[model samples]
Target: MPDGNGTFVKDFFIVGFPGLHSTYYFLVSAVLCLVYIFILIANGMFLFMFATNKCLHKPMYFIYINLVLSDVLFSTSTLPKIIARYLFQDGTISFSACFFQMYLVHYFGAVSSYTLAIMAIDRYIAVCYPFGYHAIMSNRNTLILSIVIWVFSHPISIMMVVRAFPLPYCGTNTIIHCYCDHVSITRLACTDRAPYSFPAFVFAMVILLGSLAIIVFSYSFIIFAVLQISSTHGRLKTFSTCSSQLIIIALFFLPRCFNYLAANVGITFNANLQIVIILLYSLLPPMINPLLYSLKTEEVKKILISKLKKHQVHLTVLS
Candidate 1:
């Protein structure tokens, strides 16, 4: 369906802080700018270290590389546009571009979820069946798993975006959220949005909850396995390996649970608080994950420190 001009709504205005005073726009934009910078620098360093350090050429590190890649891509998909909207006072996004962004936002998100589950599986094998971990999680198999996660996660997002694009959109074109998403776009349809919204919601649950179930299963076995260790120090060491991963998974999944439950179960809460939680959880994992791994994982941290020492020694020699 087309409007008077015989075309769908060509563009949409992204509304950030709908009733925010104009005075606070710059302050908001500046803070977001700092966050975007940190996300890039932090994730970028992990990617660099993974590629350059031969010590990181194992199945576990390979999975982490994909996670880093997803975080970088996911952050890039939405942050720049939001920042530009606040700073330049331009919120208009072409209709096609909005859909494109929406697709990416979910695509990378799904990939990250699946990859995290795969990582848990990796850890599960390493701990519970250490003798067979290598045979079970070969480097070639790890690479293939990463590739499969990226490729297979595309279709659901594709279906959601394609379903929404051709529907009649004659009324208000303002998307109330900071970014375009399946829900935001479908909610704008002039016709009843049930067909697209229902299928999309089902798929969203399958991906988010399905991946989460796998993680939960893996960790249950992990906990039981840890408890059976004969020595207290041995139990502590094994648990230490999973501490950062547990933190990362909790931050990733908990807010998502709150969000989906609020939508489906008809729970009442502040709309602003909902937005804050979504934004915080999405950005929080990426921001903190690099620091968590570098500090918590001894091998990577040692390699990083060693590289820094070498660089300093080289500088001193030059001086």
Candidate 2:
């Protein structure tokens, strides 16, 4: 499937959305398209609701905005290519184009991981040291910290693309997944990938497990603090904030652990299994993040309700 260029080539492949009746590609495509449409509209509405509504502007929601933005990037980076491949029988991407694809997908992924870690620390401070939270997480400090995470994620992702692309390709350049994933693409590399894979593995461990450890430690103390509170009401309020964060962190961290660990060890290459994990990775976390955050916060709910009522009124007047 490689194109005419001797150095690098990837012209076309039959990938994305398999295991339906041939008659159902059209139906399947329609369903996937609808899913994608809702993802954009719903996530976009959350982003808009957060940005314009001053009431929702706090350290938590500010972090949520970053999360939403990353999710939007995360969803778009792979899904469009996926939809394209299904709609058109063949799809082509140049070497450099593949590199950029790798960068965007992983870059935003790392961004999301880093942001979740930040959110965990934010909650830790809020719950553990309620009085000191505001002073510690000033607007300026949070802004600088966000910038640093993005800056840090870039070099690592770039290295991944640089390391993976130079390897020799024999015949078909088709990547099994819709997007060019770091590990899957590396497997195809003609050269040994220890130099690239090792560093990436280390980074993954630091970001995934390391973050999990911090979150666990923070929450352990948080649980202790909650138990000490005599009033049931106070404890419930505290748990609500921690609950949504816990859900998001677990979803993001677990698959990463599975992917890195499973691949490092010699595992069976069940194509169906791989596709399921990849789809869960690509789709689930981003889709659920906005839903979880919006559901957890009453402020967000009120704003959404108000917006809905106003829109309904407008429609009625027009009619």
Candidate with best lDDT: 1
Candidate 1 lDDT by residue in tens digits, 54-82: 88889988998888889989989998898
Per-candidate total of colliding backbone pairs: 0, 0
| Candidate with the greatest TM-score versus the true structure | 1
lDDT (Cα, tens digit) per residue for candidate 2, span 1-319: 5444455445435355445456655665566577677778878988888778888777787788778888888778767776666665545666667678888988998888888888888888888899999999877778778888788888778877776767775445667766776876776665677777778778767777776787788888889888888999999999888899898888888887887888787775577677778778667777787888788889988887888999999999999
Model 1, residue 61: C-alpha shift (Å): 0.8
Q: What is the lDDT for 79 in model 1?
A: 88
What TM-score would you give candidate 2 relative to the actual structure?
0.90
Ten-residue stretch with the least lDDT total in model 2 = 3-12
How many clashing pairs does model 1 include?
0
